[model samples]
Target: MAHIPAHSDPARQGAPTTSSRYELLTLGDELLLGLTANAHLTWIGAQLGRRGVQLQRNVTVTDEADAIAAQFRESWARADVVITTGGLGPTCDDRTREVLAAVLGQKLVFDPRTEEAIRARFAKFQRVPTANNLKQAYRFERGEVLPNANGTAPGLWVEQEGKLLIMLPGPPNELQPMFTEQVIPRLAARGKLSDQEAYIQIRSIGIGESALETMFECTFSRSPGLGIAFCAHQGQVDCRISSPDGRYGMEKLRAIASECAALLGDNLLCFGHDSIAQVVADQLKQQGRTLAVAEASTGGMLANAFADLCGACKFFQGGIVSTSNEAKMLMLECPECLLKQHGAVSPECAVAMASGVAEKLGADYGLAITGFSGPCTGGGENPLGSIYIGLHSPHGDWAKQLTYPGPRAAVKQRAINDAIDWLRREVLKETHRIAAPQVN
Candidate 1:
């Protein structure tokens, strides 16, 4: 927690302003129905945050002309700047240009440059331009065309009555670079922001939102300009802080976060963006430590997840898919006596499996995941989705039991997420944990 800074004093607000905050409207039915993810929003947010411009609000609508027009009109009143994505194409469904022109009370005018660019792009693709494609040249009065190097839908930047409207293609590849190179510089030139800011994100595991919130109550609201927000998903929490006018606010936030984390302690996970496995791998790479894994119900999923991350080969010693009791005995040297006595899903088997992999692979650290992912299971005490994760380090060996409710795939996914989360928490520095307020 740190002192969150207030918006500069109103008296000081009269000073030079660098940028005007805008409302973002993303238009498309695919977004609402989850057919297409709204990655454009995330990309723009990150890009703008880097430039000290805060996107105040976001609204999403389908490509219907009336609906789009209504939202644009409403947003215009509240926001001096509005950016619309999608519905700028030539298809009949792409009515963004028409709706926006209507909202501005202007007639659609054709631009020669836009038409030429569309023609040239089509020529590059070796296709004849249809009459429908001519719609790409449409523009409103005093509107400027934003060339799309990646696509035919050139973006539009229009100015009217001291308000600015920008329309960009919906595809992320086109939208991101165009905004950065063309739009961001223009907005920066307008002087909406006073100073730049620095941000650091801390990734944590084994901590729930409420617990983190309650513990950091004292420090949470302490800063005037600094901010700390907890973004939680799939049992992992990201604590992020951003501040303008330098690191004073950032440092304070980090200090308070550290203290609160120290109180809450280990299993808090990594402090930065890297995962537990990543942190471990980095440490292993630096210290020359090797690793291995023996998995059962997880079916080598953990190893697969690690593989997705780059630089894994530097420290990942190997992994064993010991799905069957026979594989466990033959590959990892898990004794039959242990399996029969304690069973596959038991803590004893998990520990033995980790140790077996470590010794068999001759690695410094060994990890094992043994669980019952099933519709039914043999163990009378253990039902479906009963899991145990094992960790074997030079110091000692440990195992934890986790019972989650879900279908087979969901349970497995949760197990893997939890496993990675726990690993991250264990390796990171201990910090006080914040516990959020409880509801009755």
Candidate 2:
């Protein structure tokens, strides 16, 4: 796999010959102190990347003119383009106008056209313009003014000594539209558009990142253009494959995804960003089946996944949280003898709970999660992180024992995820065997 480092990537390189090289600098005190997130950087980077202008660095500076000037100068010398957001408003701390003028060695001049536009904008709103609003009309003589249709502050586009600089408004409503309509056309005219790179993420559950790396180690080396990365969260692994060909090189991307899926087999959850619940929801929708859940140590976590989904009432019948042995017997109709012989967290009790819930709710399928998610053990053959997930269907009822070492929150989540994935797999398997959605 070709994993291009940022320093070596042509898009990030500062070579004068590299057409798409760009750096982003955002100016604001709000961003510096985490008062607000720097949304401009993310939006600009994504937009520019699609147009072949890849951002090498993203910098945030306070509303000080010196700080803005220093970053602008650095980007001017180092990169082909520099795009900045914020510090262009009509406030005392809004210093981008003067900073740009200083950086370009030009005097700030009040433009008649800009003033006319700003005054016209205020006039339309039936509001008198403040003296500070006229400050928005000032522009450095070296740059082109891109009018903001949504606000008073106009965006600036500057080209000097082979370096490109653009200053957009701080507000997203104004900046986003201006950048897309006004700035992108200008950027496109500068040079050849960048060759697109594509990314495909195959998410899986019940798998470790390290184990996946080892499994795909040989494939990564053999696949010339495919770039593989594994990110582990909760109990799921997000295996991302990027290709130099826009969107993982099309056919190659699909082939690589298929190969990876085969490697992961039953563990593979689904493609793209769909969560386990979504995968199960889709499968249930296709199968035309209803599901009910009973959760013990997981509380209503297992049921909540389905509940949160849109139109969950169609397929999700009901749920019960049998946290205590008494509740397990009373609510879920779990046998007293079963709870006495095996604790609530045991496989036998888990299976009974699952089957019992299915019978109670009159649903086609039932899912149950029982676990010891805690710092202390809950008196069982299992330890602190041991869990038993049960699935009940007309054809079969079974339970599996799983153990994970983590804090209480993590163990509960993992156990719930295990139950969901197992049900999804079973549903998919049934789909393959029959034409219509059938249980057993």
Quantify all predictions' global Cα lDDT against the true fold: 0.76, 0.80
On the 0 to 100 scale, the lDDT of residue 181 in model 1 is: 84
In candidate 1 the C-alpha lDDT for residue 323 amounts to 85
Candidates in order, TM-scores: namely: 0.72, 0.61
Segments in model 1 whose C-alpha atoms lie over 4 Å from true places: 1-19, 106-131, 137-141, 180-182, 192-203, 219-231, 238-251, 267-305, 310-370, 373-379, 392-398, 407-410, 425-440
- Give the alpha carbon lDDT tens digit for every residue of 1-440 in model 1: 22223333322221123347678999999999999999878877766655456688999998788899898999998887898899988898999998889878888898999889888988997998999989989888778888899888989999998989999989888888888889988887777444443355566567788777776676756756555678887676777665554435444555655766675555455564556567666656765667788889988788887776688887787789988899999998889999999888889998999899999989878888898888666377677889998888776788999998878888888888876655544433221222345569
**Residue pairs that clash (backbone atoms under 3 angstroms), model 2:** 198-247
Top lDDT hit: 2
Q: 1-440 in candidate 2: lDDT tens per residue? A: 11121222433311122345678888899898998998888788777654445578998988887888888888788887778888888889998888788878988778899999998999998988899999999887877899989999999988888777888999999999998898878876776343343355678877788998888777777776565678788789988676544433345555677777888877878776667898888788877898999988887888899999998988999899988899999988898998888778789988998999999998989999888888777564688898999999867999999998878988988888778888988887787678666669
Candidate 2 error regions (>4 Å): 1-197, 217-222, 245-248, 435-440
